[model samples]
Target: MGRILMKGNEAIGEAAIRAGCLNYFAYPITPQSEVAEYLSRRMPEVGGVFLQGESEVAVGYMIFGAAGCGARVFTTSSSPGISLMSEALSYISGAECPAVFVNIMRGGPGLGGILPSQADYFQATKGGGHGDYRLLVMAPAGVQEAVEMVMKAFPLAEKYRNPVMILGDGLIGQMMEPVEFPDELKSEPSNNDDWATSGMETRKSSRRNLVKSLFLDSEQLEAHNRVLKAKYDRMRREEVRYEPYNLEADYKALIVSYGTMSRVCRTAVDILKVEGFEVGMVRPQTLFPFPEKAIEEAVRRESCKVAVSIEMSMGQMVEDVERSVRGRCPVEWFGKSGGDVPTPEEVIDAVKSFVKELI
Candidate 1:
């Protein structure tokens, strides 16, 4: 189809439909409710299942059940709702079920606010639930990127037999943008007969597939953990994705940001460039297998004296930025919490301050 102006949440919902995801379970939550609202109308028309669970907790289990059966299933929620789904997320990971989750993050520690925020950075990239598990987290800065990530999430989940998350801020879910749905992503059912919990008669095999996370023996649990670790390592080596902006020439400072905050940082970079300051950015597309090496390369430049993380939370992502930098240079953070988005001018000011310190 041709390009059309669509809200970010609606675009993601459409993208999921186009990605062959027929099983969707979710509950309405601010900033991302449009996803459910759009799908409720579209899914049935396409002979897909759309369900609004009683609560986030219920939806999590529903997703677990669908994914265990080897169906391409997904759910969407904001920050607080994500917290409620943590238990199921842990179970899904341990069970190695292929599932996708979209988090249109809002400000929060607890029922923080309905406005856009990136406070879930730690929860998403790190372990939101318990156990040694990781989610292939994709952070999208715009609606178009969100569409692409949502389309990609399913295959990645199936390929790794792990959960994949499309991480976006409320701005990405609520704002309007022009997008064209890719015809290549039209829904096609994935073949899951190999390991999916299809009935014995359906599989026509002697053995039955059991999907569970429980391990009575400590050695078996350790072996399972090692297998999960290997998968994460493979993702780190092969799936780390990022975009570099204004890095063609030498820069004095590097800015690390993702999601909607990266867009703001790009504008700040433009503003600074106009005033004869060279500031570059590394916008991470994959949050879990963070583009650490990319950040290191950007700051390795002699002219790049410092790195700054501009975020919408109270410096949650800065930890990763710092770890990536690894004491190569001083890393600092500038952010606003509780739904306050940092303005381009504020980021510009932060960059100028860092430059002054370098001088």
Candidate 2:
């Protein structure tokens, strides 16, 4: 198919449909409402189901129920709305249901603002709700990447029998870009009969499938947690993804960023390069199984005297960067929050400041 100029939110909605997601339930929230709106019109034409629930909390369980029944399902929301759905997310994780969630993040600690922010880094990569569970979190840098991530989320969720999330900022959801829908991602319903709650007749044996997170017996629950931990460990080993920019040779410093913020940092890196300062970047594509090893190696270069985290929020992702660098070099952070995006010039200045400090 030919490339078309598409808004990121609409592209994500279309990608979900193309990915064989037949059921969607979401409540409208700023910066991400377009996904719900776009799906509402398109879902019926595709012979799929679309619903705007009364609340984000309601929509989350709706996805859980549908996913449990072997239906491919997804939803999209902003930061506050994601907060409302966290309880259901925890339950869905515990039940090991395959569902996709898209969070087009806006500013927040409360009803903070309706603009792009990466403040949810800790909420997403760390534990948002409860328990020792992790969501396969993909943070895409641009509209095209967002579409690809949304398309891939369904299969990854089903493969692991766990929830997956597309973590994008408001800029990504609001921006327009040329995108092509790949024929390779076309639809076919997932074969989930083996583990799905598809009732007695669908089962090969007479055993009934039950999907629930609650296990009153402590021993059984502990064993289940061990199995879950093993799955997470496997994901860490096999699913870590990242993109390196200008890392082919030594650089004076390393800039670590993800999602939309990385795009800005990339521009800053270019600006620095022209000024005769070599700065490479580590842009994490997957946030949960964070590209720790990649970041570690990038900072390990002898020329990399400092590593800086450039984010849209006040140092949330910096924590992860610090964990990865592990004091190999000095770690620093530069950010803007509450709906404000840091410009390339601003990031360049921050990098210069770090360099000056080292000198």
Candidate 3:
């Protein structure tokens, strides 16, 4: 609601409030603990629910409880904790409950180190849990984007009646920067009663509502999947957000990236520019939709020789980049995992090496 210097984690919690999410349920976990800590103090002041559950399992269930009660609820956790919550997250999507989850990603296969990693990109975008489900996974490149991405998450969640995740790295969670928000408080009408577990007779002559993800029959499951498919299709058509940077002149190359990795690409682009290289970047803001069109256009630029995907993981986003580029340009990947992130300088070196090969 005002201009302030805030860590990315704190900004996410604040943006939830700005977006009219009044309930937060989470456990303390590395890299993202500040999110819960911020809301724990701020929620009481605003008369909202802030709960620190015993474990990630309980935290996710707590979110389910709040969502079932027809409240706009949210939660935050790191890689392993998010893994623990995947069961409930799948259930939440199956119930078509509008909710938000933030994953300040960390490296992992099991018990990964506590530093920033985009290793969960696939998990967030491809549905970490079982069965066919998808979430709106937004990757914010910087603190401002993190704040706004979170604010957008609530409305998108309600619009689609599905879970949305703000997927950032621990660098994002710990890093600080300036953020601004609207002053006027405009609240939206709640659509919770149509499916929420509120008491009966409150709406007078309406039947009770049941919120659940259970369906035993194959035909029923088919019908459910069809509904989900249509929703995902609509999102693909309407919400594929991306940003193209330093493009007007033909470019030497296009860098494909997202989140903090995208910011690193930007820095690489700047260094390349100083050296008279014509490189640009196409950064996806909404990871789920994958921003296929902009990436395609970037790959087609006449000066573009290749598109390099730099990620903090073993190239999850690289898969999407290649799909978008569609053989128009050579695509290379440079990445690290297990809690490692490449700095802008390292990214520049990688890009230069890539360019040298093409030359």
lDDT of model 1 at residue 346? 91
lDDT string for model 2 (1-359, tens) is 78999999999999998888879999999999999899999999999999889999999899889989888899999999999999999999999999999999999999999999999998898978999899999999999999888888888898888999999999999999999878786656667766789777766657777899999999999998998999899899989999999997579889999998899899988888888889999999999899999999899898899999998888988888999998899999999997878889999998989989998
* lDDT values, one for every candidate: 0.92, 0.91, 0.87
Best by lDDT, which number? 1
Question: TM-scores across all candidates?
Answer: 0.98, 0.98, 0.95
Q: What is the lDDT of residue 172 in candidate 2?
A: 99
Question: Which runs in model 1 stand beyond 4 Å of their true positions?
Answer: 186-189
Query: What lDDT score is found at residue 350 in candidate 3?
Result: 86
Runs with alpha carbons beyond 4 Å of true place in candidate 3: 184-186
Write down the worst ten-residue block by lDDT for model 1.
183-192
Residue 37 shift from truth in candidate 2, angstroms: 0.9
Candidate 2 worst ten-residue window by lDDT:
185-194
Candidate 3's clash total is 1
